[model samples]
Every structure is written in C-alpha cells, then in structure tokens.
Target chain A: MTELKLDQALIKKVISATQNGLPICERPYQRIAEQLGIGEDELIELMQKMLSAGLIRRVGLVPNHYALGYRFNLMTVWDVADQSILALGEKVGQLDFVSHCYQRPRQEPDWHYNLFAMVHGRDEQEVEQQVAQIKQLLGDACRAMTQLNSLKILKKTGLRIRS
Target chain B: MKLSEQDRQLLNRVQQDFPLHPEPFKVLSDQLGVPEQEILDRLRSLEQQNAISRFGAVFNHHRAGASTLAALAIPEHEIEEVAAFVSSFAEVNHNYQREHEFNLWFVVNATDQKGVEKVLNQISATYEYPLLDLPMVKGYHIDLGFPLW
Candidate 1:
C-alpha cells in the first residue's frame, strides 16, 4: 500500500470540504476554489491523488438507514470454514442489502465467529428469520448472534486526517 | 490555506444539511448571494479535490422497511464467486472484506421476515452452504461521513 503524505494545507482543505461542502449550486467546485483562493484544477488534482493513495475511500453519497426505515440493523458473525471464506465474503459483499462487511478477530472462548456482516430489517422477528436461513446454509459450523439497539446513536463519521 | 469570506459562508450553510429543496442550489445561491454557476463550479472542484465526498442523502434501511442484516465467512479462494453470487440479489446491498477470522462479510436487507428468508434461502441453495445471520442487537454509532481533514 502507498503511504498518503498530506500537508497541513491539503488536510485543511479536506476538513473544510467535508465539514462545509459548497452550497448546492451549479458550480460548487468553483465556489470551493474561490474560497480557498486556489485554481479549480489544482484542487481537483490533489483530491485525485488522495483517492489513489487510499486517503479517501470513496466520493459518493451515504444513505441514512434509520430515516429510510431500516430500523432493525444487526451485526452478524459466522465461523466460516477456511476453504470457502473468501468466496463467501465476496458473494455476501455483492449483496445489495448488505451495507458493511468485515473480518474481525474473535474475542475469546465465547466469541468464535470469524466472519462478520451487517443486516437491516423492519423488526427483530424479521431479522431472526433471516438468521435462520443463514444458519441452515452454514449448518453446524455457523453460530449467529443478533444485537439490539439500547441507546441513541452517539456518533457516526469517517476518518479525519489531522491538519 | 486561506479561505475567502464567501467560502466561509458557503461552508457554514452546508455543514449539516445539503438543501432538500427542488432547486437546492438556487436556494443556496439566494442565501449566499453568490451566482448559481459559481456554487456549481465550486462543488465540482471540491469533489475533484477529495475535499467533500459528495452532496447526497443518507438512507436509514430499517426505517425504509428492510428487515434483516447478516454476514458470513467464506474461504479466501472462493470469495470472488460467493461475493458475485450474493451480490446478484437486489436485497443484498454490499459486502466488505475485513482482517479477521470469518474473513468474508456482507449485509442483507429485506422488506420483512419472509423477504430475509427468501434471500437467505436463495444463497444457501445456490452455494450449498449456510449463511450466518448476525443481526445488530444494539447500534452504538453508524455514521459514514467523517471529517475530511
């Protein structure tokens, strides 16, 4: 992986951009450039560089799960056999319903699940039913768990490069 | 390193909500007293520079009527095929590969219990393997936007 060497100015630009994007107008980028007193091309070039270096994961829209009515969201874990783990992950990732998927280290004796995915549903029962299908598919090798929300959301944001 | 007064004003307007109006840009232009074309140009530039990812809406799946979210582990070698297969379903949103034991993970969102079951069943029948459905019992925080800087 290539290292992202970002300077204070670039970092500040990114911060400002994310925190306060240009107003919804015809020439948002032009507005940003004027604000920073930089050429539009120069600003764009820097962003491309950052993206190539993995400093920026994606430039797209993020939908709000709750507002859209996907109230019941759960994080699912699985104990996938080593042989088929990658194929299975790829397949799951391609699913439209899945928002996030990742492999995290298991905690201890209680946590044996190595594979993890998140699912959203209308209610708990609906989520449970989905789990049942997954259980049947993985058979004995898979142990699934569903966690419910107990409190209000605290924070949800992406990485902030230090300026 | 320096920002003009107009830039500061524009940033302040969009920090929380990018307008939801039908001509959001027009609304912004009127508020900021800047030419509409200027705002549009600036947004394009900001996007090109990776300063702002994009001006888009965030959807809440659960509230939208989706009923389930789950993940499964697949062997490294078979990840490509499985991911392709799972992604084929309209209900499956997207998947991610993380560094962990159950390396392969994905999400499934359906309208209801039956919807979840149908998608899961389809995956099982196609792959001849079971899917582990770990539903979110509690959500601490799930925001995708971050401070770019």
Candidate 2:
C-alpha cells in the first residue's frame, strides 16, 4: 500500500486549488500552474504523483447521473452473515448494475444491515428488478434488506478545504 | 437532455482517462477526429446544461480526510427544519432525504478523524433522536466513471 504524504504544504495547496474543478482552456494545466506560481511541468509532476498515490481518483468529466437518464438512485442495505459478507460483498459489487458497494459498520438492535450497495436505474421497475437480482444472489445468507430511495437532494457541494 | 450522436461520442470518450498533455484538448481532438474548438464548445455547453457536474480531478475523501455516511430519523413535521439545520454546517456536503425510517441522511467530511467527530457530535447533540454513524469498512467499485449513453 502506497502512503501519500498529504500533509505536505505543496500537496495541500494543489488539492485546495484544483479540488473545485480545473479551468477550461487550451492550456488548463499551465493556467493552474501559473495561478500556483509554479512551472507547468512541476505542477503536472505533482498531479501525476498524486494520481499514482491514489489521492486523486481520476482527472475527467463527472457526468450528472440524473441528467443522463438514471432517475432512480437507491441505496440498498443488507444484513448478511458476518462470515460471508466479504465474499458476498465482492460478488454484489461485480454486478454491472451496482455502482457502489461497501461493508459499513452496523448499528445494533435498530440497524442490522452491514452491507450497502448503490443501484441506479431509469425507473421504479428497473430499480426493483435490479434489487431482486441482488436478493437472489445473496440467497439464504441475507436475512433482512431495505431500499432507501432518495426523495430529495438537500445539499451537494464539492469538498472545501478549511485553511 | 437530448443529445446528438456527435455529442454522445464526445461525452463517452472524455468521461475518464483524460490525457495529461500540455494541449489535452488537442490530444482528444486528434483521437476523436473532432475539431479541438468543437470539443471545448460541446463540453462547455454540456456543463451549462447540467449534463456534466464537474470536469477535473476527483479526490478520494478517505485519503484526504475523514468522512462518514450518517442518518437521523427526523419527524415528518420537522423534516425541513432539521434538514436546514443539518445543511447549515460546512462539513455536511451531500445531504438527502431518503424514503426510510432514518430519513435524513448526509455525508460529513473533515480534515481529520477529530474534525469529523466534532461535526458528528454537534449534530448528535442538537437532535433528540439517535444518529446512526456508518463509516465505510471497505469500498468496492470505487472506479466510478460509468457510461453515460
């Protein structure tokens, strides 16, 4: 596992500057480098290092799923056997329809679900069909599951670095 | 939003693995066989149309700071009030009202574990209901860039 020294002042400055999104220009990197008072090559090298270190996931367009016709976004929660979760979670995540899958801490008594899978679809029927497929895949290992459909988006913003 | 065939091609091509060259748009133009200006224009138009939320580096929240998915079961009558109160905090970036018992859900992110805890503690103290804090143990399918067409 490669550890990134995110605490470095240069790295923090770069993250803060480019986190909102890069400038749209013919020489975007150069423009950013100029703004940071660093040479373009040096800026690019630091960015490449960050990308390699897994600090920056990618440098690309982030499409709005809703605008792209994926209207229904459901966060499906599952309570699978603790012993089988790792294997089952991997299987669930491999499904083409499942966008995000994770094993999260489960709150006892009221919340027993440990596995969460995010499913996106164009409509209710499509989402239900996808959820059913997950249920079948889990089989008897899954005890209880529920789908939480997003009713409204209250707030959505990019990360703001507190200086 | 309706998109032309050319628009679809340009979007699908530029979604991920964008070139890091000096003239990145020119590189894309060479590969996609579209004029560099046209590609730029289309991207700008798409962004204006809300088709593209952002076009830049996407950071890994866990790598940069501490974050968690939290939920609170706010009563229907006070949903708006609670939602507004939660949204007031700078740490609460993505907040949503979901159809479940734990209706009010949001993601809290901060520079460190203590910062994250501070935000969570404040929210918990304000609300009479129990807050369910679910931090990720492990994430699969983190490579996001899904096909848009």
Q: For candidate 1, lDDT tens digit of each residue in B41-149?
A: 7756554544453463333344323445444556768767876777666666555554444544556666456777888888877776445565543222233332211
- Which 10-residue window of candidate 1 chain A scores lowest in summed lDDT? A152-161
Interface RMSD of each: 14.8, 1.5
lDDT of 2: 0.86
Question: Native-contact fraction for each model?
Answer: 0.07, 0.74
Worst 10 residues of 2 chain B by lDDT: B140-149
Candidate 2 structure quality by residue, lDDT tens digits, A4-78: 444468877888888788877899999888888998988888888888888888888887878978888899999
lDDT for B55 (candidate 1):
60
Q: How does each model score on TM-score?
A: 0.48, 0.94
User: What local lDDT does model 2 show for residue B14?
Assistant: 76
DockQ, structure candidate 2: 0.73
Best by lDDT: 2
The residue-by-residue lDDT of candidate 2 on B89-131, one tens digit each, is 9999999999998999999999898988998888778888878
